[model samples]
Target: MSTESPSITGPLHDLTVIDLTQMLAGPYCTMTLADLGADVIKVEPPAGDLTRHMGPHREGDSPEALGGYFQSVNRNKRSVVLDLKTAAGRTALLRLAATADVLVENFSVGVMDRLGLSYETLSAVNPALVYGCVRGFGDPRTGGSPYADWPAFDITAQAMGGLVAITGPGPGRPLKTGPGIGDIFPAALCAVGILAAVHEARRSGRGQFVEVAMYDAVLSLCERIVYQHSYTGAVPQPQGNTHPLLCPFGLFPTKDGLLALAAPSDRHWREFCALIGRPELGHDERYATNTGRVAHADAVRDVVTRWLSSRTTADALAVLGGRVPCGPVNDAAAIFADPHVRERGMLSEVEQPGSPAPVVIAGQPIKLSRTPSAVRHRAPLLDEHRDEILSASSAAGDPRHNTSQGQVQ
Candidate 1:
């Protein structure tokens, strides 16, 4: 085990989280808690979290070195290896749960129950323990879905949740987003659910099951299309880079690169027209109101496109940066180079196991005045904190020994 102690300190410093999750969704949720200063104990199987084998590893890193995927979401966490299939492993977890404030997992519906570590079983030993689960459809505890037992990933969640239905250039051409919003958005919602459960437990001295289905979370994200369809009686399709209602509110190509410009409101539209050397269009009745602009979207786009095509991205921004709601479509390199990113402290560096130099990952975005969040340490090596964890639990005297036969209510 490593000798260095995590320096994380925040509002959640008193909370302890038992993280029994592997891939993106569950791990990402716990990572958010860990960043906020929860003492997250990542319980992995003997072979370790599968993401440890995932890649984009650093140069000169040994085979055992953690990959970018694992490092990104598992930092500031202590790792403990447990073979949950065995009796001893199950007993060890029960002991940990006895003292933990929260336990979160992302296994399929019945995996925990089959292992005899269901929420009912754990709550028997610790009544105030909050149990959170993230699944494809959701547990039977929530409303049952036909796809409850089905396995799902980010792509599947995106497609089923209505994101893909309204994404892309046209009706027949749908595309998944570049980032894994299906997994990430659910993880964020799960984190919120867990925190809410934790708060209620603290107040009521009882904990409840909290769940976030990937399908449901993504559906909530695409809430716009739902109301749009309900109110308009039209199935929204991929309208390309432009919005269906708001004209001049999408990606437009500049001489060098693409920039997003939105001057949909009449006031901003007037300002935009003045800046683009076409003040006459601002007064044109066909383009005056937003509704009129939408009715003439093709003409509006043509006028804006012609003006933007002659200017570079920098030149366009120089003229319309703060005056209009416009910004260059920044790529990764542009994001890295942006002064705002540096000023906001949106990147952090942590020590790499097999390399002499440190690696950079995203920093915590949530800010606090008194108890700020931070990335205090790198992700743990596999099973790196076993000795300390066992010793501490032993010293505290197993809470299971004090409970009544660990019976579920």
Candidate 2:
């Protein structure tokens, strides 16, 4: 199958990452690295990542029957099966480790140690190998966590990490976010950790263990809540769609659907009042300043509600689009149709494995002028590159991986 864009040789082309992680958090981290042109060799178990079976899938998908969820995070990388439990498997992995600039995993605490592949063990073999992981609480290397052995998923982390408490419409109405930010935030942080470790390794010829606890990442995401509690001794409740300190900076119902408007600043609030034909309110004593408006939040919301109810989302945006930051609450179809999204190249069509038809996924959010990262190849098949990778002599057979010739996409 042909690609949508020319093969991108990215800025991280010289790096190699051994991906022992599976599922969302771990794979998501490596996927970011893979997208940037690192040689991410996904070392899966014989049964494969559980997400390999995750749907929704197309009819004629590969024997592996790779599903949409699997394809999203595993693209732009090669795959190889290895039973880490087996002696030969462990032997093969350590050999591969010798060539890896980084090795990442997200298994529960002590899985690597149980498998005799801990950072202490691997670092002995490859002194410059950056060992990174994402865990529920955290690893003991950086800081030991009391809940180190606790098993946590996205929801658990969201709840334990304080996000769920402050999310949703009101107190006692805690809500988990639609996406798995609990896992994703930790993954993003781990990526930064890997890069930092790699940078230091380049300078010192030494590597260190880097990790992110899902709970810690979620807490970091809710930094504002932390300070509010500390500064005022007030446990912030869910303020629905509104900002805690900024009145008129939240969701408002429009004629057709939900739309968001933010007039937190005095200039924006005055402009908003003028735009809604209520210029007098800009100077009204009741709504004079942000503090006064927030002191009478219901009155503020009522005015906004009345104004927005008079217009459709499109009509509202047409007038306010550039005047202030605003947009409609978009569905998938609407997002796909939006000109701004297309102009920014947010959606990308790619040759997906199993599906005869190409599927569209998100493009890189971080764009570089020279490197211009992209989705180069489809997600790999099970053990797709085993022969080419396991045998250094046979690496030439895989033209994509002949690094000596500067081709490593």
Candidate 3:
């Protein structure tokens, strides 16, 4: 590690991860680990991770400067460039892996095998190394998928995993989610698997390969539809903002904007009715219970809509903020201006290269009392820590040549 780099402090500070991942899914997973104080060494190719070339760069930043897409998830980690196609590069990676607690990658199914850096090979060099990977379909070691050889991205996974099937304003008009849940959800699961494998490795003095398929992760995320379809013997369809089972449990238009209100329970329903000046509706047999309210969803929606039509989102929130399960449908501007975001430190500022003003990105959500996660510094420049990493690896000495397997000095 470079002395100029900020010191990492968290629950995972002792762990060293060799990251051979590029783009979103893999980078996101490693970023999570890095945030938790893992010494993550991102081993990029000579040209660098493709995301570095992506646009939306800071003002006055040069062509070589990393863009927001890369910076957003690559922070709190060091970078080292290597030509993995060459024998020397492969040898260097093996040296790093010898000292690593974990090795993570997201290349296609056969990429690692082709590069001769498969989990089997690395684990032999360091038996206690927890190898983790994220794939579009899945790795053969986990379970063979028919589409294993097919190229995939966020949209493909979302569509195949059934997320797109049950999302949108109406049936037959499916829409992809605004964010890359297909990639992000898998990354989260992969991170969990890595931590679990690491824990077991410490206890058993052996490591295991942890894999997460993007398709599988997204399918798990859309669990509700699976159960719904199975139970009803009918395929689930898009129900717009409203849930099929819950009445008055979705977005409603207000004078100035939209508000997401959920008052399905009898207690909440009664209070909501009273707040909306429709107290009699609370006692009405047709609208009393959640079941009955679901039966009369249109009526319930009409009542809520009618009341909200005359009030701005702020005015509506004033009456139902804490009393009812209600919140304004916030956009980026509203979120930025929100007191909750400010107080919780949900947005983090980091210094940008060639820019005086710092750029803000989403902060770590996992809060721990003793070892809270943090962004210690900005993303590293390409090959920024190459010399330091190589020197450190050399000083540590290759564990591959040692008598004991997977022992970290």
Choose the strongest candidate by TM-score. Answer: 3
Clashes of each: 0, 1, 0
Q: Which stretches of candidate 1 lie over 4 Å from their true place?
A: 1-8, 403-409
lDDT of 1 by residue, 64-123 (tens): 678899998999899999899998898889888888889999999999999999999888
lDDT of 3 by residue, 1-409 (tens): 1111255478999999999998899999999999999999999998899998886876676565667899889999899998999988998898898878999999999999999999888888888899999999999999988999987899999999999999999999999999999999999999999999898888888889999999999999999988988899889988799988888799999998899999989999999999988899999999999999999999999999999989999999999989999998888888888888876767788878767667777888888888878878889999999899999888867656852545643
- Comparison by lDDT, 2 against 3, better one: 3
Query: Global lDDT of each model?
Result: 0.89, 0.84, 0.89
Looking at model 2, the pairs that clash are 62-354
Give lDDT tens digits, candidate 2, residues 1-409: 1245646788888899999988899999999998888999999999888998789877766665567788888888888999999987887887787667899999999999999888888887777788999999998887988899999898988999899998899878988889999999999999999999898888878888999999999999999988999999999877689888888889999998899888877788889889888999999988879998899889999999998998999999988889987888888898888887787777877776555678877766767889877777778888999987799523324322322221112
State the displacement of the C-alpha of residue 169, model 2, in Å, after optimal TM-score superposition.
Answer: 2.0
